[model samples]
Target: MWLSGAMATPIEDYALISDLHTGALVSRSGSVDWLCLPRFDSPSVFGALLGTEEHGRWLLAPDQPGARVLRRNYLESTFILQTRWRTDSGEVLVTDFMPVKDRRASVVRRVEGLSGTVLMRQELEVRFNYGTTVPWMRREAHNGKERLLCIAGPSAMVLTGGNIPHGSDHRHTGQFPVRAGETVDLELTWYPSHRETPEEVDIDEGLARTVAYWQDWAGLCVDRKRYRQPVRRSLLVLRALTHEDTGGIVAAPTMSLPEEFGGSRNWDYRYCWLRDAALTLEAMMTHGYDDEAAHWRNWLLRAVAGDPDDLQIMYAVDGGRELPERILPQFPGYAGSLPVRLGNGAVDQYQADVVGTVMVALSRMRDRGVDEDSFSWPLQRALLGFLERHLEDPDHGIWEVRGDPQFFTHSRVMMWAAFDRAARAARQDGMDGPVELWEALRDGLRTEILDRGFDAGRNTFVQCYGTVEADASLLQLPQVGFLDYDDPRMLGTVAFLERELLNGQGLLLRYRSGTGVDGLTPGENPFLACSFWLAEQYARTGRLAEAIRLMDQLVGYANEVGLLSEEYDTVDGRMAGNYPQAFSHLALVRAADAIHSAEAEQRLRSTQPAEPMESSP
Candidate 1:
């Protein structure tokens, strides 16, 4: 039977490897339990990580008991991972993750000797559709050597390695040993079932090409103001999460890794969020990776070329729109969380902020001089008109929830941003639109937001109209330049955040439980992105010492491999929620850049007039 003792909830023990099409998170314990193949949103052919290994897997590690892990880390700036383990006999290392190439199908594993002889185990279990379907498998010859092949529906994989295992349960099993002065190379090739097996000869050359591809991609980053290490790491991560061929960025690698561990707050983040994509593109562009930005912009245009009203806030990485939400009852879930989920149901919800976010991205594109397609301007006009029609209505906010729509204050502010930014784009870029009407609407929205969303008595903006709760999202006012950072109102919100949301570990939770924003069990670890936003806000408002103190504390929360999850359980000092969240990493870059830029701005202003500040605080 497959063992469960080696699984880690902290994401520390697991090293992630992906081809940017899909990814697999492999714990050091010889198990390949979590992988959604072909595409990030595709059904898992191996999901034993969330359930039992019986659910599915592609394991190839030492089968010995009592073996312990030594260390793990990415190979330099690339997504390739090296995991070392030590046992009584000696030590051995397993290098895992998919090989990166342009549109070809392959996953290469290279195991090199380090010490004395070490016995290892290899077990392969293939279950498609969340472990419900066993694919047809057979042995074949490629270049005179026998290779195992599996094909189910349209998905297919070819694994090449040493010491072919013998099995009768449709699962491959074997035991082998590795000693000093030897190397073993394995490759898992994925191609369409109808297509013939791909050409595969040397694994070492593929490994080198994979490493060089990522290094060259990451070397384009031009950010040098500050936080060089973390910035580069986040950039590497963002690059890792992106699909190389389509240039579509998945929100995260895995899905159903619940927010509340055993709770039902799990979601399929495999699809792309327009809001996330826009911010991600801005981050990439700022770091001097315009190629990704252009690709993403192209993806956006193709994904939303239909009616403006039909514009989904998200889409499949390949621009597909039909993400049907469904439950997989075959597997229990992570820690018995129940009803394992696939596909996102939020595609039908209307989020006003998505429009504003898109507008902001288009504006950023125009400002950066990134050339757009001929239809780009026309598409923006349709979206803005749709925004004009629905600007006054209350719908679901940025946080996709099932509860009744309420007048979320932040949503209105973004609507104003939509009009204001749209007007700016038209006036400044010579793009023709209803600039005059949009400006009037923009001023009117500002008036409405100031009158309704702000609490004059409390000197802060409420989470929504008539609500006194302070949301960590309110901290975004200064970052968006919706309000001045040093404004007394923003300062009051900052103080309120500290008073209400600050946990003992100096991280900020999203909000208090009493507010019914999200319709679920009202408990979660402090969101890492929100806390980082607090740091940036602190830096921007001239609370530099407080910013540094909080920033340092949060950075310490990263796993040993310099990776972070969506949330952090401060009480246990463990990561919670989704593993390697794009939201967390994206905001991290922005905040780090924000802090560094703020510090530079502060140093510059120490000699000039206080009003000499150039950009948003």
Candidate 2:
């Protein structure tokens, strides 16, 4: 099985919990394979996802054989995750979370007995920088309390919790039997090796504060009479993606897991994409998260404050702009896939669509009542002016093509969107500078795309002009509102895409294979975000039943933790690409919104009275 070694846990066995600063992926078996501490963009200390046991991991679970798990769910409205494992002997619940208490770095894993007596085991291993660094460790005392401080060249981690025993070769282990109501907590903290150890954390208070913080932030979601559940979850995921202190949002929580297993298609996705972050803001605004909108807006300004031409497509969570990509040969990779990577090289790519995405997101933020104050208006205007000069250029599209730049049709459409939204902003909001000329320019852009981007003979939109292949991203046309969903050409494009991009599993790939648009090795799985796009397109085009069915199927692809990857291996029915993608979560929100819309309409009609007395009076 392709998934046999590729997976650390079965798709049915994991849960995620986070502080919006970092996340942990915990298996129902009580193993944590993926977690990057200190920050979301930080190098992983527990990176079993990219490689194997040598890469680092932590486990705490019943030692009994064949312990079938019962269930797992986040504590209501919080990042605290609880997974229950029911064995013939007893029931045990494990709680995992990275606390935001005091703004210091920490991960706390707690195990509790919920039923009859059960014996549990704990294993802890520490490696730094994608498992390339082997830390020096010793058991020590901090303020007369027991702690194990593991020190690497530049980084260090201090661990303190319940009595976890230190073993040879730096591994930590603890095995104990507990009856109903017994509990244990394990805390791990990372800091600079040369620096003094962090202050002792009050585990109880930190746990309470982290839970309260997530619940409070989740309460800020903008909701209406619509798809409340998925919308809330998407909002929660977005909030989890956001860096609490700095307003940055990481693209996803992992990297090098591959869009196709054992293939070289894997690339790091741990940094912040201006485009993705901006689109997330749009999603949040739609759901009434103005405060987050404002915070992200501030983060955006800080991240791309330089000359518009110097702006990077993405950035570090601290607004750092220099992320030079590199490969890690030490870790064996997820199931020996080899050559684990860090820091995205796409930062150097000229994805023209990025500017348009930013403009559209900013426009949405402004439309949703986020006032563009003096600083904001000037920055947006400057970006628009920059686009005016470079709008005609063809660089990489939204796919971040590795080969050469092609005139990607979607890129052209987004350029049109950028100009159109800017023009709308100027005309309606009275923001100054070349509104009429930009409107004219915007119309010219739309005409250019219609002329070159569409294939009249096929009655469909191509991935790029002169290329016959269909792109899953074409589904984005209605999303960005480039055309009405019912347009004949749009409907035709949908059909062509359905014919070409649809895998047997009913999800869409980024594009068909024959064209080689990505300019890399071919044959990957259906992208989860694109699959959700299919549902959104279906819903918007009045295929409500089909849309609902497709949405349910797509959501089902999410792992047991309610976390989705960037793509799914259609052949093997497993997740691929970077795990826990923000794009996927946002798509869930959009599709759920569509499903709830139909339900609301049905309810409204059903509730109406059969007869009315109009002329009696």
Candidate 3:
């Protein structure tokens, strides 16, 4: 669980469990190696995933020398995981989950002996600030029981039960044996050190309630029977990555899990990017999640409350805006990928597409019957004003390229989408706005894109104004209702993308990073979200068979538990970038829905009665 040897666990080997506010990564061997306390962006308390066990971790697995993990999976429609391990003597089960809809932050692990007597070991090493500070440990009594209190700076965690391991040599260790039909429970709760250590929770009741909570939430997902399992799991992952209290969805729980191993492409993804969050909202809203849309809308309103010109690309889970990027040189990164980063520098970059993404999501919510309040619509108007104010400014683009700004065609198209949505809102919802101006801007931008964004000779839209390179994001052209998927122009773009961006196996690159477009080293895997987008493009364009094939292929990339990272290494056959990326899961949902919609349309057309009477009439 704590790495097979000196090597870090494969990124795909980690399954995610979350309380909604934050999440933890549990490896197959039953070690919680990556967990940020309090919030997804908080300093990690257990970061052994990126470093050695000395960087801190919580291990609860068979102590036997040759115990092997037989299987692991989530309980039906829930984040509660059951990992079964087999040993020469017998078998044991470990159930791990974080209680949802709870009062405090807690993770509960229950180990039960299923068949025979098994020796189990529990290890707890608490580190603060990305494993740099060893917490001061003390014993405290609460609710007629003892709990281990660990305090380092402002963060304090209480470990209860499990006959908790005793600290020896700065690490807590305990070995206990259990026979068939026996169970043991261990819990860790985090809170501010200033607050009184919270009272212990009822593990049995909490476990039952947590299971019920996740099951009920999952039950809300719109069933897509074609790819039901992956769709449901992806929806669950989206929910898991969202902050329960704030409604802010983080891109991923772990940060600095490199896009390219041993490369500086590693970036912190714990914060909420407006673009990713908006897309997530759109995905959920399309699949029977109106409440989440409302919650995220409120979060958006709070996050962008100030002057529109000052709006940032991302924010903390609680709507905090001061996210300054810094490198943590202390803990060597995952697989020795150095420069573990905190925060994201892209927050300050001008990404022209974000407003459009926000508007599109808001528009979807409106279409789904979520009425806009005074603040929400007014906020959009202000955002539109801001967009108009900087209509011609070049941006860093959606990939958050560190290179010089460029008039990215994708960003320009999304800017067009923003105005188009505004016009629709005024016409359809009867909202008071400058519809004439919005329509004019939308039409003008469409003409401009056609003129400057497309390469006539290649018959493809370039990545930016001047570059001839095709970007995978061009697959989204039809998605925003900007162009017909099968139109000659879009078809040309798709053809060019297939020729240039798609790997032989059919995965997509955001762009050839080697082109110096990103101003970073070239080595990176195909972005999984772009592949999902391609699947959507294939679906929308009536390439149903190809769409299904691509969809199935992309779904297969999910880990055993149906979790997808940001990218996949085709050559090395591994996951890349941040794990359990919200972007990837949300895109999966959209792609699945696209396939379902296209298939349904095909079936409807096939079943239609022949129209012979029209000739006579």
Candidate 4:
């Protein structure tokens, strides 16, 4: 499915539209080059973004190749995309969105004439099985309406509209004219080939309902005095990546986008990682989406229902356990990044941070008035028991390092947090549990970390038990209650990270790849989440001006539509890694909230009388 000579559009030039179950990426030029069927991890029905239009694409644009894109934006907090195109003779508006209220899986594109007559062109190429199979297409009448039906091995797609493109060389092409005050609608739907073809839906009505659905959900966010728009947009993206029925949140919608283009760092993030989903739930709860938290907790229960020792780091959307990684040779990948990947091999690795992350999130949920039933409490106790079995084991760590396992400082700290939260829950929250045992475990781990994980000469915590390299993850020490924000040890660690991890543009990299710690190529962009964590740390330690400056610079990296990728290439000034990463956005919300809270506190202090200063002895 790799393009032979076609030049693919830049990743930044595309916008996303989703139906909650799946998403479609549309370039500004009005070509939908990437779309998955049934679910986020399903096979692509339109994958031209990874290849070319010849592989699969549905384009609706001005017939004039010189048409200029005037502007594009989502419809007021919703994923409904509106792009206006201007030609020398006239102008037109293309509205794209996936209907959410309906059961049918479809995408609707409506073209409206905004000015004088404009010639429009429609091209349809439906390639099934990741663009490796061209479907057999034919024109037919379905439900007394003319439609273009395409059939492949087990999947079928039908295109219903007034202007049916004629077949030409296994592709469909047509030209139509729309005068002022005219409109044309096109809808494409997917269904199993064995089942009856689904009926068409009213595109206008569906768009209205979808818009309301998103705005209503977004309206629930607690008002933020600063960065409200971007916060709202990030929340929307997280919702878009979540599976509505299953309550499983995906890290990103697309797979094999590459952490470093044309490098071997590519991975599939379509499945639900325990740590990522837990952090996402924490973000949602912070923004007043407690209902989502409850749902995801139930999903976790089902996903990890078996023996705690057998639990995986990730699971499928429906709570299935198996996710074997494999390479898709057919796809040339984004920007010639080869061997597109599906599933994830990291699921099998032991990431000790995962259980601690989940425990912390559940603690937050409890603090927010979520009553933990027997099911949840017992499950947590069992997870703690599982941790007890591996108290001194090495793990893959938070970054899922492919190298030999090590006793990562961050992972050990998180395990301490897990035991600490459990003890607090039982003693303070009046929850039933073994509090004394938990406290002893927590204290023992803390002493061990300070003794073995700290580099006393440098006054900094190292990446692992023996390494001298510092990790940006140390910025999270205050966040998880391992240490005070202004603790001298933490401040020293921050200084070391700023000196070693910051790129020339002052953005933070996850770690120095050249250290040979990750067991891969020695290059990657600055991780956006790590940078956000630094902003949060600054705010907590009373460095208000420094925090504000870094927060502003970090948010500016978001694309034009307010979506952030996992990493940013400071040198090249473009996004890297998976597009619209959940971790990046969640960290953004927390960082913005920190700044808002700090500003409010500062304002209140200025209005009140200061306490009398005590004389130093």
Candidate 5:
């Protein structure tokens, strides 16, 4: 009953459901188009997000044509999704979720009829290894319950519930009728093929437990009066991206969603970037999640345990080091973007800003009363030694540009910040370290950046030394205390960015393409995070009204479920790139915090008595 040739759903139409170990993207049409099992970086079992339905997908919707989606939203403070649909014959509500803290990975879908009799259809295609392998499926009975067991090379899945689909030509299909007040439940569990089929889950217990888990976690967030809903949801999203066992936070779930539709700018984002993870930690700690900071710090120690010289920009969710880039010829690509990639090659590049980000985050943890431990402080000292060794090395920079390396201004500023934080920690926290050396290095780097990285005549900082082009990363200079937000130089740089990088719709681009800087095709939508950074800048620099306007506009881009992708195509008004991106969500949290702080300060000032006109001079 499902259409094999149906067009892929728009990126924004997908809502994320995660158990903190892995995630699935369920479309508005009730299709599970993307899901990686066992881990966030694992091969997907449902790969229709990148290719056609023939690849893989799970669909559960009304069999009747013209069944309209009335509304869909995540349950309060949780990833549990509820979608209501209405048809000529009847109405039905579908609830989808993944159980938290469960021993096994599974997805639960329950359909309840609300009105007259209605017919519903379920279709599933199981393809392992990113749609390259078809699984062996068989119908069997487990504990007197009918179930469908699917086994591939090493991965296996079992479908058990009130209704099971029949198989034909390696595809499963089923149709069932339900009347008002009737409910049908279906649960899918993934496990190793060598093991026995997983038992059917208790649908009622799982739902209740999942809801409670999310609500409890969300309740821990400190209350905010402004942008409360968005900030809370964004924090929940960051938590969802974090791996429960390893404490690794991924950049995004789905990969190879083109930054530019039908373009080749796509790359995998399932791995954990040190910079991204540190930033995520900072965002969490800013809102009273110090536990996450300590957890991720342990992950950091394990990841970079060996020689600090061997530090990489990113690693696998479990701290894997060997991530070789490869093209999947099987996937025709999302929207015809070519050479769908797996395993980021940038993992091997030297991104100078990574260690700096980690250090800044750890410094924040220390400030928040997370005392430095024996291993943690020693780790910081080791990282400082590594920076001392590579102090002058040109890096690929924060964007991981594929072109020739350069002394990127933003990276240099972050490097300065690393040493600045280290020296301050040594002097203030009484932590043992080479404080004098760190202070000297920090000051010298500051001098060099101001001399060469800045364009004196233009009064704006360049993307890298020996260039006039502005970069969005420069917007973060004030974030790390490299400069004051309202400094004339920073204001000039913001002006330059507004003129050069603002797209037609007033959103900020990372930088102008075609400058031979990134060494790729000249195309991509405005990166969502950069605009958020701009919002933070505006909020901090006395431009409260402008900041509020930009903040509202940026928040509006979140989908109906308050989820954001990596980029937004203003021309088409659709989200592009990886869905539910951690970078975007974390930046949103930071921006909202900045706006709230600014608003609070403004209120405080309004209540204060005037300065008595300086007593008439």
Candidate 6:
């Protein structure tokens, strides 16, 4: 029920629409609050999500006061969003989507009158370069159709439809009344300002083709009776975050959505992180999407196409490596969060776990019958060589802490996983490599971890070699096969995490920030991905009841259209951090798969007859 000129809406109120290049966040009240053109990391054209409406936004809703959202949901198996609004006079439906396979990037909003005549309003303020530059506006005829064109610097966008808005004071405004059975369609297209303006798209044809493409992709998922809807939706979110042409998957479509609202914990997540992308690939591969897995693998090969010693933990969507972090001070951040940032500084930091994550995912693909090309295997060997040279190097760890580097237990275990997977590939799959050396290195890591990482007195593994802290990332130990889920050490670590990291509402925090481990403020919401990892651990350990209860609670946090953010604020009961986060959704898919597997096992046990009782004397 948010209105224009008001403070930004909660993170959960936004739904995502993507066309495989860039994405736009549409608020529940019918506003495009955030949109980056050309690519995921491009500058924003609708930056109202992070600042005032004057920054930039597109508002399309009823012109009447108290016109509230009745309901909203995405069309089945697709990112097409349909929202129904009810005013005092009548009802209307708004459909929003970005057509796939289109030449120009565009957003299509179609409005249909469902009841009595209702008046609709349209307001657009296009600011390029993250809301810093207002575009030069003009009206021109393209293909005999009058369109409003806005050009600024290198970016240009055209607004075309039956009802073109009139501009005044750098804002476009229009109003029209629609009777029942009538419809109106508006399209916004972005292209290079230096090039010729693009033509108007065929809305009906684009819509049909987009729907078919998504449905066809979703049809490839393996059938799951339990948690099917959320799984399917989560899988689609992961796919939506992926760039089709480059095969690079971004962590999220957003930049600087605060992890802690009104705090300095915000960081950009628009780039492709190797760990997140590899995990996303594994999740998709588990559900019968090997083609996507191979595509991402090819992307990996292209991204790390140089000396492995220079490999970065993340890269741009097109594999560009120069990501310099900077702040935009002109625009106030989301909910007063300051210093909205662009680009990720963590690209320069060494995270030991990333190589292990990539190796494990590639190994999974190989096990699933994916043949590595000439370039892929050699690149992996070079990566192992780099790892061998940096075997004793301290790392910033998986959370990418800004604090001093340490030999994190999770990172070390993943290092072990890298060698283990390489050895397995060499021995079992006949992949050429130094299997003996890999085995020796793997064993050495295991011995060192057991000797230094574990706290035998507490029967738990510590966060690092010298710290006694329990990190929620420890829950992933069993995930990488570092230990059995039911191992005493893992159980002890889980119990410690529950006691130390769980908030009042039983959600998990990444770690105790008060320990200065992250070198930041001590307040933030519980990370959704960590909680999902806990759920997976519970299911794997035969705690089916607990796992289902936790899974239900976590899944319930998803917004109206089955989208989850990076974290959930249990105190305020709202989502925090970036919207439609790839990490959160991919972890949800894995957790659901674990729970489904546990449930099937439980059913099989129930169906089995008990063994005949022994009649011993």
Assess the local accuracy of residue 3 in candidate 2 as a C-alpha lDDT between 0 and 100: 28
lDDT of 2: 0.80
> How much is the lDDT of residue 344 in candidate 5?
94
Q: For candidate 2, which ten residues in a row score worst on lDDT? A: 1-10
Give each model's whole-structure lDDT: 0.79, 0.80, 0.89, 0.89, 0.92, 0.91
* Candidates, ranked, lDDT: 5, 6, 3, 4, 2, 1
Candidate 4 displacement at residue 547 in angstroms? 1.5
In model 5, the runs with Cα more than 4 Å from the true position are 1-7, 614-617
Instruction: Write one digit per residue (lDDT tens) for candidate 6, span 507-578.
Output: 999998878777777888899999999999999988989888999999999999999999998888999998
lDDT of 6 at 356: 95
- Those runs of model 3 whose alpha carbons end farther than 4 Å from true positions after fitting are 1-6, 140-146, 610-617
lDDT of 4 by residue, 1-617 (tens): 23533434766778899998888988888899889898888889888877677768999999975698899999899999999999877899999999996877889999999998889999999998888889999999777778999999899999998788999998999999877789999999999999998877777789889999999999998869789998999999999989988999999887877677677788888889989999888888898999999999999999999799998989998899889999878777787876778889998899998889999999999999999987999999999998999898999999999988999999999999999999999988998888999999999999999999999999999999989988998887788999998999999999999999988898888999978778887888888999999999888889989999999998898877888988887777788888779999999998988888889999999999989999999
- Which tens-of-lDDT digit does each residue in 190-235 have in candidate 3? 9999999887778889988988899999888889779999988988
**Clashing residue pairs, backbone N/CA/C < 3 A, model 1:** none
Worst 10 residues of 4 by lDDT: 1-10
Q: Please state every model's RMSD to the true fold in angstroms.
A: 3.9, 3.1, 2.0, 2.0, 1.6, 1.5
Off by over 4 Å in 2: 1-8, 142-145, 223-227, 598-617
Residue 74 lDDT, candidate 2, scale 0-100: 86
What is the TM-score of candidate 3? 0.97
Which pairs, if any, clash in model 2? 50-333, 50-334, 222-287
Model 5 over residues 137-232: C-alpha lDDT tens digits?
999977787999899899999998877999998899999987899999999999998887777767899899999999999999996899999999
